[model samples]
Target: MPSPAAPPPPVVTPFTGQFGLAYPIICAPMFLVSSASLVIRAGNAGGMGAFPALNYRPLERIREAIRQIREESAAPFAINIIMQKSNRDRYRHLELALEEEIPLIITSLGHPGEAIRLAHQGKCRVYCDVVGLDHARKVADLGADGLVAVSYGAGGHAGTLTPFALIPLLARHFPLPVVAAGGIVDGAGLAAALCLGASAAYMGTRFIASCEAEVTSTYKAAVVAAGCHDIVNTDRVDGYPGNFIRTPALDALGLEPSLVERILSGSRTARRSLARIRATRVLFGAGSSRATYKTVFSAGQCAGLIDDIPSVQQIIEETIRHYHAIKGTLP
Candidate 1:
């Protein structure tokens, strides 16, 4: 009779067990928006946070950031690395991660064989960003610790499949934990993700509007103001389809790949070169912060769901509370 034994807590995800997370949520890494400050805040708040290594230059900064996170919080966090050959810093970043013995490494855009191997040696885990079943199969065979199913509504390099379609597919086909990433911005989305067989929800765009995000105020405001219709996919950013909030600058660049882009994309090397070219022009050309805000603001359809710029702690607390509320209502 002792308070009915408190009704035993509902199981959130296998992800929590894998990493000792208090909640099954990941603040997905955003290229320029994610910062060490964000990671620290999210980690201390009981959710895992990740930042791209590309966000830091001089390479040593990656080492410093990892150490800083460890000093500030005991919670788990991850470093995201673009593993393609085009990323000259990929190998060095991977070495840094291994040397630091970071808790997690998230690989995107290439094979994760080496990452998985090295991470295992260091007692760390590797999660690969996979958009399809074929790619998922490859990484699973390579001994990936988990899979991040990047669906069509995802902010950055999005996939063609919806969360409903991709999450179940990956969950059914692989024994590895599946984390759903897309237009997931709130507790309801988190609940739905778990119901769809995902072990956790990988949320990116929603965190861009957080108080800890280092992005420009203009960018954060844009995300709060935009909606699902305001989001569009364009291949001009990295020669890969990425979701971004529509702005006059983006519209001027058009959504389709140019004839040269199409023609040169016949080989992997050519595609990488073209991606660098376009990224330089569109992503890096805006020299001033204000100019960049007007040009390229990456966001997902989830922008519609995020109306406030709350602190990272508040966001995590609310999401979990709401998740429990929703779970309780289910028969």
Candidate 2:
């Protein structure tokens, strides 16, 4: 129960390499959870905070979120979009980002071409999340300004690539800015990410447990209690391979590991099997595992390293201290 150690390095990631934010940190955009307050707080604290556009209710709610963030903070922030889920209103979201001249926008779960076009014309940067070199290359060619490399431990539709391997590979040939995501918790990890040739560190679990984040107390506690091993990357919940803490609710369901693997791999039966499980038995499956719905809780492997629920400012201060300590040791 000792407090987490002081940060071990001093880092000043260049702001203009990709994201125009002061520090090379981007809060991962959580669907249904990221709020204007949280995003503004992170941006004001010198990191980029993101809210997925899908979280908005009325189309006007999206503009209100953007307006509020701009009113409260001067630092850069981003809006995340589930490109695959974008409907007729996608243009509306992009239109507002353009009219407001937002700093950054990241597109996930789909293509970034149209959004990227809008972002570029408005002088804003467009970022896309990719699981591997192929997708990484595709996004870059789409004229996306950069990529959020979603490797192992990332919350949604994640891939099992090690940062050591993936970062280096993407850094080598991707030809665009790269934000390394997954397993990034404290300053040490952030410092390591920069060392791995990333321009920034995109974090989800760290923000999910924040005081300002719009997560349920039960979900936040689950994050504080989980370690790297606690999260299960499964297809039982959503069709994607997301990470979450293994709860008794999930365990009560007598699903096998092979089935979970098949679905996570995008096997055709994955979606159908999950639908049947949700419809047939109530208690057999845990919270939100049906094909139509998703589990309320999604955690990152970083949960293991984070034990305390610190404020946004506290985290930034501690991270800055670590950035310095690591810099002090460098030649």
Question: How many residue pairs clash per model?
Answer: 0, 14
For each candidate in the order shown, give its overall lDDT on alpha carbons.
0.84, 0.74
List, residue by residue over 126-194, the lDDT tens digit for candidate 2.
Answer: 888888889988888888778788888777557789888888788899666788899887778888888
Error of 1 at 200 (Å): 0.9
lDDT of 1 by residue, 258-297 (tens): 7876787788898877666555444344323222323588
- List the RMSD of every prediction in angstroms: 4.3, 5.4
Pull out the clashing pairs in model 1: none
Show model 1 residue runs off by greater than 4 Å. Answer: 1-11, 262-273, 279-294
lDDT of 1: 0.84
- Model 2: how far is 149 from its true place, Å? 0.8
Query: In candidate 2, where is summed lDDT lowest over 10 consecutive residues?
Result: 278-287
**Candidate 2 versus the native: TM-score?**
0.84
Question: Best TM-score goes to which candidate?
Answer: 1
Q: Give the best candidate by lDDT.
A: 1
